[model samples]
Target: METRIFFNPGDSIANIHDYNEAVRQGQIFKRERHSDDLVIAKGPGDEEYAIFYAKDAVKNPGKGQKPYDVKNTL
Candidate 1:
């Protein structure tokens, strides 16, 4: 299992709702052989999930990690 640290927990808390909506819409974008997931909403918090946006993305340095990012075409 990979660990996703909120890039900024403050922002995470502030935009969690939107994150949840994206997830609901199946808008959670994931890259191939990458651990970056795109954030596509801006709402409140959903404990079920949190995001680490691309503004300051620190890749896993290897294959298969799970954080948050942007650049969605869906």
Candidate 2:
């Protein structure tokens, strides 16, 4: 499985809602929110994507060997 991340400088809630709608409309496979700053969505294929939100910026978790941790920040 391959994973990717996307950043959107918009309301996290709205973003999540959009993903949920997509899932409902059969546009995506699944979408989930791990935290206030993290949301995960899966595509029809083997692709997984995530969206990470920070105060004024949106960040992608990016490809990593393991799940990115959002609790600890410097």
Candidate 3:
């Protein structure tokens, strides 16, 4: 049996028994998004929890191609 470990961004600990069990049983599927990796897990009462990982770092917004001013506007 291959032990697949998934990291939950919300929780620092990696060994979440419930999540591991769910994944092992194919109840939940891990999906990756453009900005971050997502762990989609099914919760009780038809509720779902999405845990995001590897969040994009905050970047400084540089000057735009065109200056923002009344004169620059055409």
Best-performing candidate as measured by lDDT? 1
lDDT per model vs. reference: 0.39, 0.33, 0.27
**Is 1 or 3 the stronger prediction by TM-score?**
1
Steric overlap count per candidate: 7, 0, 0
Error in Å for residue 24 of model 3: 21
* Model 1 per-residue lDDT tens digits across residues 1-74: 33333244444422434544655444433443343444442212333344444553444533433344332322
State the lDDT at 1 in candidate 1: 35
Better of 1 and 3 by lDDT: 1
Q: Model 1 off-target regions past 4 Å?
A: 13-22, 25-46, 58-74
Query: After TM-score superposition, what is the CA distance of residue 37 in candidate 3 from its true location, in Å?
Result: 0.9
User: What value does the lDDT take at residue 50 in candidate 2?
Assistant: 28
Off by over 4 Å in 3: 1-33, 47-74
Give model 3's TM-score versus the native structure: 0.19
Model 3, 8-63: lDDT tens digits are 32342122335445343232333222233433333222233323232321123233
> Which model, 1 or 2, shows the larger TM-score?
1
Residue 31 in model 1: lDDT: 46
- Expressed as tens digits, the lDDT of each residue in 1-74 for candidate 2 is 43343334233232233444533433222234333433444322323332334342324443332332232111
TM of each candidate vs. truth: 0.28, 0.19, 0.19
Which candidate model has the greater lDDT, 2 or 3? 2
